[model samples]
Target: MKVLVAVATRHGATREIAESVAAALGTALTDAGVRSQVEVRDAGLVHSVEGLDAVVLGSAVYLGHWLEPARKLAESFADELGRVPVWLFSSGPVGEQKRPAEEPVVVEDLVRRLNARGHRLFGGRIDRRTLEFPERAVVAALRVADADNRDWPTIRAWGREIGTSLARLERSVS
Candidate 1:
């Protein structure tokens, strides 16, 4: 099986999250005794989705919206994505509130368009040093503190679930 894990990140935090997810999926698939390959890429850098079996796409949310590149990827690949098993994730929401914020309006539409198998919302990270002037200003305005809220266990467990499902599909096809 071939899986693509794509993400759109602003300040690298989301990229790290994507890496973690890809690694977890790879590990799970391997543990299941399934021969699989997973590729992690920036959504903007992926020009094609051909030959992929499944996809896990995620984005960093800002002001309750996914970044433009991630949004464009979903819009441009809607038809192709609909043919495969796809999972969506959003990494945003800082501070003491660790729960995932609501799905962005555009992302909600993409979910329907792609008929995504599932969507998960993960907590995000905020680093004061990484913020540019405007981002820092917005953080200050919102009183959002610097923190990393990603839950590794939850992410790994979800990856395992995806692996299990893919393995079942692979078995059924054979």
Candidate 2:
């Protein structure tokens, strides 16, 4: 099986999350003795999904919306993606809440368009030092707090679930 893990990030936080998810998926699939190829890419750079068996796509959420590149990827590849299993994730939410301030506005539409198997909302990271001037202003204006709330164990478990499902899919096809 071949899997593509794609992400859209701002300030590299969501990229790290995507990497972690990819790594976890690779490990889980390998440990299960499942034969597979996994590749991680920036959403904007992935132009085709021709040979992939499954896809896991994620994006940074800002002001309750996915970043444009991630959204555009789903829009552009909806037909191809619908032919395979796809999972979506959103990363952005800080502070004690440890959940998104709101669901990303694009998720529902993408889920339907892509025929996505599942979607997850993961807590995000915020660093004032990395913020551009306008981002900083928005953060300050919104009183957003700084924190890294990504749950590694949960992420790993989700990856394992995907690995298991793919293994079953491979079996059924074989």
Candidate 3:
């Protein structure tokens, strides 16, 4: 089985999340005695979802929306994605306030459209120094603090679950 772990990120935090997921999934699949390959790439670099066993696509959320590249990928491959096991995740929500209580609106819609089996909303990180002027201004205006709120254990567990599910699927087919 081959799994593509694709992500659309702004300022790279979301990409780190994708890497963690890919690592955990690969380890889980190996532990399950499943022969599998996992590839992590930027969502924009993925031209197609064809010839894949499963996909774990994620994006960074800002202002209740997913990044355009991730949304475009899902929309372009809706048919192909619907046929395979796909999971979606978003890295957003920083600070103790975690202002955005709801997941990105795009994720909910994509889940229905693509039949994604699972979706996770993970806490994100913010480093004011890395932000562009506009982004920094917005963060200051919102009174959001710079912090890394990602939960490594929870992220890994989610990836492991997906790996286990894929292993079961592979066993059934074999």
Candidate 4:
């Protein structure tokens, strides 16, 4: 199975998460007696899913919303994705906010409407120097610390779940 893991990142944090997910999924696929390959690509550059058996689309949260390229991909491929098996994930929420700020609006809602197998929120990271003035100030005022909050074990488990579901879907198709 060819799995495409596409992500939009501002400063490479989300991209790393996407890569980790793909790696975990690839391992699961191998264990499931399937030859699977996963690739990490920029969200905007992904124009086709012709040869892909499954896809995982993820984005970094910025002010409670997905990045522009991530949103564009969903809107552009909504119908196609509806016909295919897809999972969505979001990476954000660093430094413990009152409300889990990483909740992505676009992908999460679309997953419900599209009947996607799952939608997950993976912990994310924020580098203080990467932020713009306003964003930096907001983080500072909110006392958001600069740290990498990605939980690898949790992410790996979710990826394995997705892999298991994909294997099931493949069986159903056969």
Off by over 4 Å in 2: none
**What's each prediction's TM-score?**
0.96, 0.95, 0.97, 0.90
In model 3, which range of ten residues has the least summed lDDT?
93-102
lDDT of each: 0.89, 0.88, 0.92, 0.82
Encode model 4's per-residue lDDT on 8-118: one tens digit a residue: 898898898888888888888888877777898999999987777888988888777899998888888877777778888888777765225445667667787656778
Worst 10 residues of 2 by lDDT: 93-102
lDDT of 1 by residue, 22-48 (tens): 888888788878899999999999899
The candidate that achieves the highest TM-score relative to the unseen native structure: 3
- Report the lDDT tens digits of candidate 2 across residue range 1-174: 799999999899888878888888877778778878888899999899999999999999887899888998988988999999999999976767876667788898898889999999999898999999999999888887788988888877887788888877877888
lDDT of 3 by residue, 1-174 (tens): 899999999899999999999999999999999988899999999997888999999999999899999999999999999999999999987868543467788888999999999899999999998999999999999998999988899999999999999999989999
Against the true structure, candidate 4 has what lDDT?
0.82
For candidate 1, give the lDDT of residue 22. Answer: 85
Q: Output the worst ten-in-a-row residue range by lDDT, candidate 1.
A: 99-108
lDDT leader: 3
* Runs with alpha carbons beyond 4 Å of true place in candidate 3: 97-100
Ranking by TM-score: 3, 1, 2, 4
